[model samples]
Target: MDCLPLHTLQTVFGFHAFRPFQEEIINRLMAGDDSFVLMPTGGGKSLCYQIPALHRHGVAIVVSPLISLMKDQVDALRENGVAAAAYNSSLGERDSRQLLARLHAGELDLLYVAPERLMNDSFLERLREIPVALFAIDEAHCVSQWGHDFRPEYVALGRLRGIFPGIPLIALTATADHQTRNDIMERLGLADAQVYITGFDRPNIRYTVMEKRKPFQQLQEFLGTRPDEAGIVYALSRKRVEEVASKLRELGIEAAPYHAGLADRERSRVQEAFLRDDIRVVVATVAFGMGIDKPNVRFVVHYDLPKNIESYYQETGRAGRDGLPAEALLLFGYGDIPISRSLIESGTNPEQVRIELHKLSAMIGFAEAGSCRRGALLGYFGQRLEEPCGNCDLCLDPPDSFDATEEARKALSCVYRVGQRFGAGHVIDVLRGSKNERIRQLGHDRLSTYGIGAHLAAEAWGSIIRQLIHRGYLQQDLANFSVLKLTPSALPLLRGEERLVLAKPRIKVAEAKKEPRRRGTVLNMEYNEDLFQSLRALRKRLADEQNVPPYVIFSDATLAEMAALRPLDSEALLKVNGVGVQKLGRYGAAFLEVIRQD
Candidate 1:
């Protein structure tokens, strides 16, 4: 029992060692202590609890918010030869009864459930009758109202400690800021839990935010280089989801739409297809990506701006979950700001609205940032990167910044002259001296700042306005039809006491670049391409035969290891990184046959 974690890691999960903070967190949990884990997506958040659950006495109960995630994790665990089961609303009566019987009989290693189900009195009584090992709560941020994906069901989880006093509990989340983290701890009543924030930086993901220039065309161009790769495209509306999905199909890409507007069965089908790799791309809204566990998503493209940085980070975090090189492309324009603002303002909670607005501003700052994108992103999470990440758009080809003091002043003056109530477009029109009838009718043409900005084009002025908004000089008042309002901070700029240096809007071509190297691989090792492809084909065949995703069989990194270290027999094959005892018995023969042929 003392060596169970190491045994499980090597014989079941088939990893050489634990990731940075996993071993520590697992040890604490196995010691019958509560814990809080803040690891990024694909950072092995599951293993921290799964391994401990195996090490503990009774069945480990994992509270997850999404049914899809529950099934995916349970499937992956079973694939690793762990006796795991998921009980949720999706299960039939007979299935639920059998699972409950299994729980009573203590025949399961792990049991995944929803937070709502865990709060039931009958469930608590049933749990009390059995010796529960520990409670593992995934997506713990859902307990905090300040979190991006707030679910009311999560609030009831506070009773877990009160109900099962001696059982250890672990709360896990991939995204949480300082405020949200505090709220999560207080809400879950994990005051004495050992908190581990493993870091927010996903170095394998390359962040690229582009101006939305012909969005569909831009999307097609972005997808041109990633043929047959799995990814997600997020739009702002259901209409856009359908439009993008239809267009992707027209272009002969295997794509589908998933949103709240779709029927539950249709949505389930789409999600299952995606998990099975039947669909390579999913065009969706914000509703699509909370609990997905697909490991090999190669890219995540934001067709519109996400309302807050948390949402953006969580959405982008869905990619590269396999610890491979992934891309996050955000196609933003001024129009997206208003749409996101309106969505945020429509929410019922005032305090929540204010917090969301502030987050939106920070997200805009990331989009309009001149420096490192990763720096700004991680800075928001309270983690500082010492240097440029060298993977984002700015680090790859640094954008130039211009001293736009006069231009900013001119833009602010124009907003002020237009009664400070016009949106960016109307103000841009006034600044650029457009011969529009509305400007003439409003007599804004007579203002001193009317044509003062004509030296710059309307697009240029719009860029300046966006930059001002990002820099805290101006606030887009969604309550006032998204009119530009000068903040008190803008006084310094208006008084000519501050200079504004803004990054110039990038002009990009549609050509593709070379693919980035996958992370966690030895770059210096020369591999036989033929052998790698052969192994991949075998993996796909095995995955298809098992009716599971390819990565479930073995990750590309595992296959690369197999290709580089071609072993002759099972004894040598078992020495590979991902080949645990179970996998060696299940898949070693077929894979060894390929290597032996080579």
Candidate 2:
């Protein structure tokens, strides 16, 4: 039970590195201690238990929530020559027997099972017969009853140590708000465990929020700007998921829908398709994306507002997992406020529902705030920043405002003249002097200020209406899909007693600009870096031609080797890990030609 061998395991795992606090967590577990790991997504949580399992005798039991995640991790480990197996409901009785026999024989280093199966009496008996190395609970936050995703069976896991006395246990989660953290310890019986909390700051992701009128058109505008980026769009309902998926397909974006309502096999297919990059955007509900392992997703957009901030944080975390730049865009409005309130109000216990509603309200406040979105988000997570982060929508595109005492008075008067029963579009038409049939139907043409503020464009007027909602000068009637309704705060602007300054929303795209810097560890090579890129381009070309994954021809390791060695002929190239005689003869010349051009 020690980490004297962990340094070797790092190299064995094919990672030239580990994150800052990985070893600290591993060392605690190696010493037969308990631990609660709260690292963010893609923060090297798997290695904490996988490496330690190799050091101890017998198999380590890894309880995972998703069979897909289990299979992917096992496949990846086996590819790197590690022995792993999964025993879940998916396995046939025969396969389960064989897997159990293999476990008894100590043939597997790690065994992944679902929490339901882990609680089986026969499974526990089989496990006890074999010397248990350790027990790992992935997605441990689900064990907390107070947590957003509480699974009933997870409470039983806290008593596992009593069943296998002296065996170590580790709990890991990508998200645990303060309440969930406390619940995890109490429910999992890890009160004495060491806590490892990687702070919730993901500086690489620039958070942006926008208020929308026609969501479908706005979605197209957003994706059309970054067609090359891989992203996900989250809807609130299964019907909306399918609708958005269809719309994106019509717009010529490769997209798919994934929800629990889909067939299990179809769901698996979509999940696998996304992992293989066969689809660029997955329009899913909150029902999807818990244990997903896709590391290259470049952005995450919420077509509808999430129920709470913790859900928002965890789902957005799936982006930029590879430590690359990413974006999180949320489209929300006052309609989402009551939707969350209804969901919370309908829960079983009123007190619990009220508590959850409070959390949801905080999320709504963060979404609509005029301050920096990141600052509000960090503050909700108990983090404080003395200065505003210059990356959010408020900082990057500072809203433009003029002394709008007159404009505010005119807009409010238009709403009042129309009796305040209409939506934003109607309000904007009256202000912009667009006397269409709808305006005539409402008899809004007779208003005194109807054509007085025709100086502003329709888009400009839309920006004013949204900003007014955000600044509390006006409120939206959610029952009317957020129709314009003046709040008490609107009186000052109407009376010319106070200056009202509101800025137009940003309607632009960010350019893809990168600063030059050296990559992670330079191999000792003389080949031009541009030529190194050329080889990679050819590898992708060959992979597409052969209809196989690029890694099958050459791994990143092999590419780095080529960049270091810059081999001249087949003899030197054949020595690379993935370069058998077949690879050298089949695809060697194209790579060599690119290197020679350097």
Candidate 3:
């Protein structure tokens, strides 16, 4: 029993070693102690609990957030020859009854359930009669109001610690900042649990942001570079999702639209098709991608700006899960900011609105950052990167900088002259000397700074003001109609005590001087492209026959390894990273035949 975890790792899950904190986490759970894990997506978070479940007594109860995610996990576990099942709304009456019988009989190793179902009174009573192994909560950030994707149902999960006193419980999430992390601990009553924060850097992903000019054309140009690759295009509205999906189809790309507006059955079909490689792209609102477990996504393009950095980070983290090079492209348009802010302000809870507004401001700062983009992103998570990541747009193609000492003074002065009670629009208007009626009616025309910036265009002035706000020289007072107010740091610049330099605002996408490396290509070793494609086709066929996603049979990363290693016999095939005893018996022969022929 002491050696069972490593034994299970090789014979069942097929991994030779544990990732950073996996073994320690599994040990804590097995010893009947609670834990909190903050690992990135595709960082093998599930295995931390799954391995412990297989080694412990009775069935491990996993509280998942979505039905699709539950099914994907259960499917993959079952493929690995584990007795795992999901009890949810998607299950039929007979199947649900049988699953319950298995639970009562102690015949199952794991059960995935939604938080609502697990919290019901009858379910609580039933669990007391069984020998439960442990309780696991995935996406634990949903329990915190500070978390971007807060769910009211998840708040009730705090009761789990009280309900199951002796059983070990573990909570996991891919995204959380300092505030949200503490909230999750308090809300879930895991204050004494062992906390593991593996880090937030996904080095395989390249982050790029471009000003939104003819966005559809930009998306087309981006998609043109990587053909037949799996990706997701995120939009702000359902209408935009449909529009983008339609346009992509017209261009002969295999694409589909997904949003809350779509029927459940239609959404399920689209999601399944995507997992099976039937759809090359999914144009969706933020509603999609939370439940998707696809590991081969080569890219994720934000058609509109996300409202917050957590949302943006979680969405982008969905790509490059397989440890392959992927791209996260954000089309940042100034127009999207107001739409996002209006939606946030419409919330009835003032506190929640305030939190959301701050998050949005941080997100804007990331987009407007002139230095390292990755550094800015990680800084928000309270982790500092010592150097610029050479993968982001700023690090790759550096932004042009110009001394803006005079421009900064004019912008800060206009904010002061406007009584520090106006938003950026009115400030920019006064700076550019607009003769609009509101400006004249407010009698702001007489101010000395009113026409000081008249030589610059409205866009240039807008850029300067935004940079000042991001640089902490100015702050947006969300409580007071988001008016721009000068910060203490603005005094020195206004008094000619400091010089300022800013990146010339990028209004258009920069053309690459050389052809960039194709995304989703293996970086470590060169694999035979033809053999990789053949192995992929074979995996797809086997997955279709099993009525599961292709990744359930084998991930693209594993296939690439097979293509690279070119193992010709069963003994050598078992040495591949993903090939465990069960997988070796199931897939080794089929893959070997292809490798030998090639």
Candidate 4:
């Protein structure tokens, strides 16, 4: 039962410390206790298992939902000098046998497996023979029938406890409400397990819920400021993923497409490039999560609304993993909802579809909400926040409030004047008094309020429609592709029957433009970028020459400090993080000379 402090292990993993609730969970599991970890993505749940797995004696059996995720964790573990392997579909019989031999021979510390493989009679017999330390279930939320991502296999995973009665089990998921959490415990036969619930708020990620007007334009506007930052653009379909990736590439971004449709090699290449920071953005579907481990991702944009806040939180949580400031910009509209509904409904039973759709609609309401996106997000997870996060679109937009009853009445009148058959676009055109040929031919220009409301712009009418829907004055017809319909609430505005004060478009916060080429500053990049590369080579060479790991010479953290500050002396390098007097004497002069040559 000997152990190192959690903080010490965090530093060994190249991190400063555990995130909130991470240490508590780690201590629980490290004490040989069963626990359920309900943590959001980017919430440091990995460390909860990883840290304890390293400190524990026997090999940790990690039950992952996907082979991709298994490979990712194994690769990351090996990267940090830990022996880990996975027996899955990706491996041939030889590899699987080799991995099993290693595990049984006590040569490996961690092993990941798909649930079906673990359920096999032969696999279970083999696992029983091995000295299993702790049983870890990743994506534990999938066990719940109420969860959106219910996998029957996950439910079967609970039988593991019955099979291996003495093995301590730890279930983990990034996106689960209390009900799902409870379901996971009950289903996994760990109802009395220590429950660790981390707060769902990610303040580092700026929550943005924009009206889905010209989603491409919205995407471009956001990227205009952050062209160089790495990000993920989540779409609902493979076609949309390809289309958005193509469009972003056309816009001169280093973008790529990812989904189950792409070849495994191509997906692997793109994933590698994204991890290496070679690509700036990845346009993908929900298939892109779980396996992703890269930190320092600056943004995550969702072109289509996610089906639930759980999905939304997990996807957005991918950004800002390094505790740095990032943005979660999700573009959504009423049209995206039914597409999700129909997809799930057509494939599943009627009752289950109904329940899933209801959850989706509630999530959409949050997207269209004018209040704090963070507050709405936390509230959905059953966690209460005391204040609106000032970083979201609603907080930033701070729209102007006025009596929209008269305008709403005029807008609905304008829609009615045009026969109530047209969509929001055509209706907005008429409300803003546009003189297109369709308007002229339809003769809606003759309406009393048509030219009278000429002061409003089309975007303004768009804002009005968004607010109308948000206020429940307008309903989107799900039977159609979200055709705007005047609800009973709209009747007050239509006849000036009741008063309603609503905000206008908030002040546009002009974001700084992206300068990929370093517009204002000019320097010899060979000396700048190449110099940093050369320093890395020197650091590695010095480390090898001294017979120690590179960090033992000076960490990458110190190397970066030397590059950024271009420290030319030993004393200067000492000021860098991780640089100490002992190592300063060992390798400082060599690095200083590398920079001095510049």
lDDT of each: 0.85, 0.74, 0.88, 0.72
lDDT of 1 at 10: 83
TM-score of each: 0.83, 0.72, 0.85, 0.71
TM-score sort, best first: 3, 1, 2, 4
Candidate 4 steric clashes: 4
- Candidate 3: worst 10 consecutive residues by lDDT? 511-520
Q: Give the TM-score of candidate 2.
A: 0.72
Model 4 C-alpha lDDT per residue in residues 1-598, reported as the tens digit of each score: 3547544453345444456777888777878889988876667677788877877878888888887678667765654556788889888889878888898898877889888888889989987787887889988888997675788988778788898878788998878865677778899999779888877777778887666878898898888977557799999999999999999889899999999999999997887677655688999989887647665577899999898777888888889764556788877777877798778788557767666675676576566555456766775665656665777766765554676676777777776677657667778877777889998897888877576566888767766675665555665443243356676666756665678776655433222232243211112112255665677678657645644334334433345456667777766666654454445555568778888997
lDDT tens digits, residues 1-598, model 3? 3567878888888778888999899989999999999999999999999999998888899999999999999999989999999999988999899999999998899999999999999999999999999999999999998898999999989998998899999999999987789999999999999999999999989899888989999999999988968999999999999999999999999999999999999999999999999999999999998857899999999999999989999999999898988899999988999999999999999898988987787788778777567877876675667777988888788779899999999888989988999988899889888899999999999999888788998877867776666566777665456688888888999999999887787765463233358532464777888999999999999999999999988888889988888999888887777788888888888999999999
126 Cα displacement, candidate 1 (Å): 0.4
Q: State which candidate has the highest lDDT.
A: 3
Model 1, range 1-598, lDDT digits (tens) per residue? Answer: 4676877788888887888988889889999999999999988999998998888999999999989889888878888888899999999999999999988999999999998888899888899899899999999999998798999999999988888889999999999987789889998889999999999999989998887889999899889977857999999999989999999999999999999999999999999888777899999999898878887788999999988888899999999886767899999787888888998899998877877886787677678776677877886676767777888877777777898999888888888888888888889888888889999999988989888888887767766776676555777654345578887878898998988777786544222244455533533455676898899889888888998878788876678788888888988887777788888899999998898898
lDDT of 3 at 326: 87
Q: How close is candidate 4 to the true structure, as a TM-score?
A: 0.71
Query: Model 4 segments beyond 4 Å from truth?
Result: 7-11, 400-598
Clashes of each: 0, 0, 0, 4
Best of the candidates, TM-score: 3
lDDT of 2 by residue, 87-127 (tens): 88889999988988898888999999998889899888888
lDDT of 1: 0.85
